[model samples]
Target chain A: MATFDLNDEGVVVIVGSGAGGGTVANELAQKGIKSVVLEAGPRFDSSDMVNDEWGAFQKLSWLDKRYSAGGWHGAVNHQNLPAWIVKGYGGSTVHWAGVALRFKEYEFKTRSTYGEIADANIEDWPVSLEEMTPYYEKAEIKMGVTGKTTGMPHLPWNNGFRVLAEGCRRTGRTDYDSGPMAINSIERDGRPACQQIGFCMQGCAIGAKWSTMVTELPQAEDTEYCEIRTGAMALKVEHDDSGKVTGVLYADAEGNQQLQKARVVCVAGNSIESPRLLLNSASAMFPDGLANSSGQVGKNYMVHTTGGVYAAMPEPVHMFRGTSVAGIVGDDVYHDPSRGFSGGFYLEFLSLGLPFMAAFMEPGNTGWGKSVAQGLEQYDHMSGVWVLGEDLAQDQNGVTLHDSEVDQYGLAVPVVAKTPHINDVNMTNYMFETSAQIYEAVGATDVYELPAYPASHNMGTNRMHAEASKGVVNAFGQSHDIANLFVSDGSQFTSSGACNPTLTIVALAIRQAEYIAQEMNAQNI
Target chain B: MNGRLSIDVYQAIADGVSAGADADEANATALKAGLGEVVAQAQALFGSSYVDIPDDDAREGILRTFQNEGFFQGVRWAAYFGIYNNPDVWLKFGYQGSSVEHGDYIDRGFSDITFVPEGPTLEERMAQVKG
Candidate 1:
């Protein structure tokens, strides 16, 4: 509820108040530093949250004009909407299933561990897992993730999860759990425990899920040092002649342009928009883009290699009766070159409403075949797993500004070009076969393989590298060229590890906040 | 209500398209208004009498003419949303609608398992994995 003046040059300006920007705002505010968070979407509290899937999607999804290219199925299927990210106050966190996971040590060093994958531009994270452990713990504690940090027990197994666990056991796979979820199994912080409404992705209507809209943004405002300006779309990061970011030029709620001066600018507008903003901010001093001295600003875009495997059991599984993604089998989430792929994946339990199942069970606009209809008819008897794995970053697969197309904001629409690598194809095949086998070992009558939905875990557009020539940002998410500019979102990911990116994004933001505070106190900028 | 496709026509299309779906179960008024614009555009593109074309094959042919158009996608999505979320449709498909508002079935049926187990319980499996 706090408000800051547009001319306030002393505040840190954080764009996109989601997992990253919202966390950064709260962390900085806790450090006695003032910040102004500019969220491009409207503010919606729990009152606005709904259990209806399509309704929540309309309220939360970023439906901005974007183009998709490259050989990825998304290009042909979801041509205009390549990513299923949110645009509102909490960003995608509003719609997240809250599977909080940390990248393994080997995952942090993908480039070093999985050496010389052809056509992949993989790189090791400048900061190792060892460096991120403390921050990850801090994030787990802060987000109330169900694990050792919090004494809260993991959620009880729903029927859907029971089916998945049974299948895993039959297949000789181990290492499955109901959590590490950010959703509350018991009430903690100021939020209530999850009612297991089975609508976690549709913006937890009861505030059981940790979202910046209900958590960080409010806590930051309680400090009276943070001002969250909703419906403010950041157009460009304005910089001075000396290459220091001065402020952000944004279009306000009424479509009027305004410049909010800042001592520091943190871009956390998810992966696509974070890089798109930089690409759009091309100036004489930095003609290529802001923080593009290495020409890696919008390169190496990665959404995890993903697909879905669902099986129709003879009995009523009622997969949609509990949490959407509470169970995960992590035995396959390790790197073993013997598997014919460099990286590995996790088979996480996932359930979709009948409408979404009908739409996304197959690709293209309309999934009207007999197989698709029968699959929808058997919704109650189905249990599924979403295959989430490490997606190798390729230099050619990235976000680029379209030449001719313009959005309603008069900016060139971002063209998200992505094509699955040979490794991705091989890995997906293995996952599909393994999943089908597991279900078959259990009592599955029919199995369905669904292609990847639009990019859910968008990462690696402004990646971190120890060497300035290899990446756009440094180990601390600070731009090498502009000391005061930072990429505090999933866009700063070096590699797409075989886990969900929210926990990592939050941990990195917490770490980045400490660095930014220390640097500002020392007047390093 | 968008002045192109009437509610009756939209309901008829919905009933005709969806197998075992009742026309009254769908949100006919809303779908008619929402999908009316798209239906108008389809009519404009294919022919003015596209909606009134009585023959099922001729209507299918007309709809196919605008397959790549946003109007067609809209009409299809409208039918999907209307038919899928209907309570009667859910009953027919054996889908127990939204459980969150009335508390989860955690205590009621979440732990009920009738199928024979191929391996140990999840806890035992976890213990074995840990070892």
Candidate 2:
């Protein structure tokens, strides 16, 4: 960890070290700009990746035993599973299952398609797919993503692509073309190519996948001007009378609060904490909170209402032999209103459930010792796919400060309130039917449908829109009210496009980093 | 006066409220009326000798209801092991032997044993249950 005097200046403070912050830090450091990235979690590497399920879950998760979704109201008392969102130096990219897809062109212009969803503050994104095309190219090549996908400006063509494309052709669904992913089939940077080990979600013990700890952050460290400080929690940005970022107030590991001066501050914590930090920084001048002049700091929360279908086969499928997700079926996403819904979905084969998780997910009839033993015997024969769908951007699904709940830092905990749109429900049911049909197509018997509530992706909180009233961030992901402050995570998504968000997230991060770098060089400050 | 069971009615009300019953606000008016009938019945049964009694049945009933309801079975195995394996808890509930003996208890459905280890904890050759 690097430490600097509070009086020092000319440093850019990036709040998170995840996909967005890590990318931004690397880009800035390469431009000969000094940066100080403050991450709340500890720094870890491939060696730190644990083998046991519980150990792996701890290394790669944020929500813990103590944290709850504000204890069951409109906020369901649900335990968020150990999803790909990582807590270490690499962020989520470390443990990601590594299936990435870009959003479709129409996902940008949602208001035009859905005709202004009821009670939703929907707006067309100021930037389009064309504008972000180059950044997407740079990110794909930099991260060494494999598989040829259609509807993108640049990428290689591969066997997975040919198979999925042929499958789509056979089904007569033109939209079923395979999209490019971030996982490496053949190595692209200095790292070795993937051996196709299925435990990519367990943090890739061998660094075949590109986590920031091995990729961008290491490069940023070599630059000498960048200071990476893990276990440092940034509380708020302190501004002078001119309203430009002067420094940041943060706490150390031992609960000691301190200040670090900076020329600029960019917050890149994921949708949950990024908005919470801004709301917690309330002052007399900004009663509602900093960078919240429109008072939409934590509004329009969207998590793709993720559900799935799991099936048992007669023989061992060896589901854990390759990547957690090898292929995707994206034919279902479109602007069609004839299906009596506003949104749609995509599908991909998911990893096999581990022993304990499989035992728990088994039906209620098989709960005792005999039943648990029987379920364990059928572990290898199971395989499934996720039904990743879009959630309507609604005002009702928002994050607010829970007055009664205080975290370990004495700050008010973020209370998330979610109410699924009727369209979301309809689209969810549609996806269940589609999943069953696809499973049947793939010759699956004894299939079961998973319910679609308590969505996992967790996106679209700090939405980007053309008008300041409609969103918290501008088209370039800059805070509309605070000139020097910016946001760069899934929070800036306008619509939850019916696909996994990492490819889009990485592309957006690259674009935003470029925008910031160009503006800094032009002396726009 | 007499050895009467101490019935903590307040505890029963609290338990009822926590279990999501209509005891607190929903039946407050009815409870106020029903107290008079119980008071008169108590006085008629043992005049000047009536004493407050603890309702051991309520405590036992709560435990039995939890067992019957099958709540927190699949979930919270951590809490289950915490109470289930503790020897003091087994002794209080009138069960015998160590955690290894739990299998036998499961089969018998009574969790009782004839002999307990004794005599200064010297147990290498103890033959208490051998006969």
Candidate 3:
């Protein structure tokens, strides 16, 4: 790994080394552009990855103190855990279940296509699917995503996914398959194929799944132009008088504050931390917060309306024997207003071990009680689908800094509140009914509808829009207020599509890198 | 860990709570604080110590009061991890842990995994339960 000097004012400082920041850094490095990547957590390679659920969770999950508020399940049952993101070098991509799907055309045109959704902060993305398709193709090939375009076969299904696939088949749904997964189906990209290890959420030990730790970060490092400094948590983005972000204030591994100078700053710290950093970076020039003139920096935060739908079959499913989410049911992924919701959802394969199933069945209740214990008694017979749906963005549902309460870092503790819109309710109810139908069609003994767990798909805080007043960034994730500043992550999403946002985030970062390099060449501030 | 329960049941709960104590100190503290709350609440509700309450339903009612508290959820998390993480409990639930070393469950035990073409009717399942 290369190291850049603290006073190196020529480097582009990219915060949060996840899919976005990592891809951007690597892409920029490929262009011979220098960058310093500041990652909040320690860098754990595949060798350090643990397979045990609890062990891996402690090792990878961002368990720092955060408060949840509002009428959602996270607030009621998981008040202290609003979202579950990784704080490591690769970020959530390390823990992600490699289910990659590109955004539909209408998904990018939410406001135009959905047409005046009530009480929703709906807006069309400035970039269309047409513009993003080429980048998505690049991302798919780069990440070894399994699909038609990538020319890579999808990974094999586990018994858990088999049950769901069989159910989908019995229900007359033909759009079901084993992939679009970024996890390798064959030995490619210097990484081995997935061995169906079941614990995909835990870091893949063989590096079969695409993570920046193995892919982008290493490529970036090999370029000798990108320095990924792990265990450096970004506190605030510092800017000069002209409102151009020039450096980053971060806590080093030893808990000492250090400022690394930069020519440009890209905030990719997910939806929560990205906005939280901006809100904390408030100055006299931008009194409310940096690039927050629209008052939307921390607003419209979305973790897709999600839940675990498990069915108890009469036979042992042994759902935890293969890749966690390679299988998906896409029959309900399109819009149909007759279904009483403007948007739709996808049912993807999910398997929770006994401990996790016991934890999330009804999170706030006692686990030893017969209610959940009985559910666990049939753990071997269970097959589940994780519903990722279109959760409407409401301005009130977002991340806000607590005035008095502070974290161990002495920064204000972020309070992430999410109130589900009625659209979410309607869509969720329909999702439940249709998902239950898929399971029941194949003779499921019982269908268990579990509420939302801590979100891994957190998105849409510093969104993109053409008008500066409507959003924080442009189509390219460039800050509307600050020319040199950018939001290069899922935080730049204008709408929360039903699909997983990693592919889009990676695609956006890849495209953003080109734009950034062009601006550097053009000598634009 | 509460003494209000009978010795046999109390031992099981105690074993679980003891196992749970190692999960995280925060969870253990929450559980201990909650037990303290339960003791006081039991006295207030029944004019007797929790152990001397002598009725399971009354004791359950007292415990239900703290269900929404952090301690309650913490205890739930601890107990589940404690109880479920136990290999014996896992065996009872027919769960196999950590599949990577076992050739990734590809060929072994991934085949002939049955799903009933048509499941047992409610009356049929009820008959099995009754039996």
True contacts kept of 1: 0.32
Mark the regions of model 2 whose C-alpha exceeds 4 Å error after superposition: A1-4, A64-84, A148-179, A359-377, A452-456, B1-71, B74-131
The true-versus-predicted C-alpha distance at residue A145 of model 2, in Å, is: 1.2
Give the range where candidate 2 chain B is weakest over 10 consecutive residues by summed lDDT. Answer: B113-122
- lDDT tens string, model 1, A174-220? 78888889988778998998777788888887888899889999999
Give the clashing pairs for model 2.
B5-B53, B5-B54, B6-B53, B6-B54, B7-B53, B7-B54
* lDDT of prediction 3: 0.85
Error of 2 at A223 (Å): 0.7
- Give the alpha carbon lDDT tens digit for every residue of B1-131 in model 3: 11122354436756767677778797778778888889999878888889999877777678778876877765565556556765445665777777776767656765347653322233442333231
lDDT by residue (A172-216, candidate 3, tens digit) is: 898877778999877897999888777889889889999988999
Task: Write down the worst ten-residue block by lDDT for model 3 chain A.
Answer: A364-373
Candidate 1 stretches with Cα past 4 Å from truth are: B1-11, B14-78, B116-131
DockQ of each: 0.21, 0.01, 0.23
Clash count in backbone of candidate 2: 6
Residue A440, candidate 3: Cα error in Å is 1.1
Worst lDDT 10-window in candidate 2 chain A = A150-159
Q: How are the candidates ranked when ordered by DockQ, highest leading?
A: 3, 1, 2
Instruction: Give model 3's clash tally.
Output: 0
Candidate number with the higher DockQ (2 or 3): 3
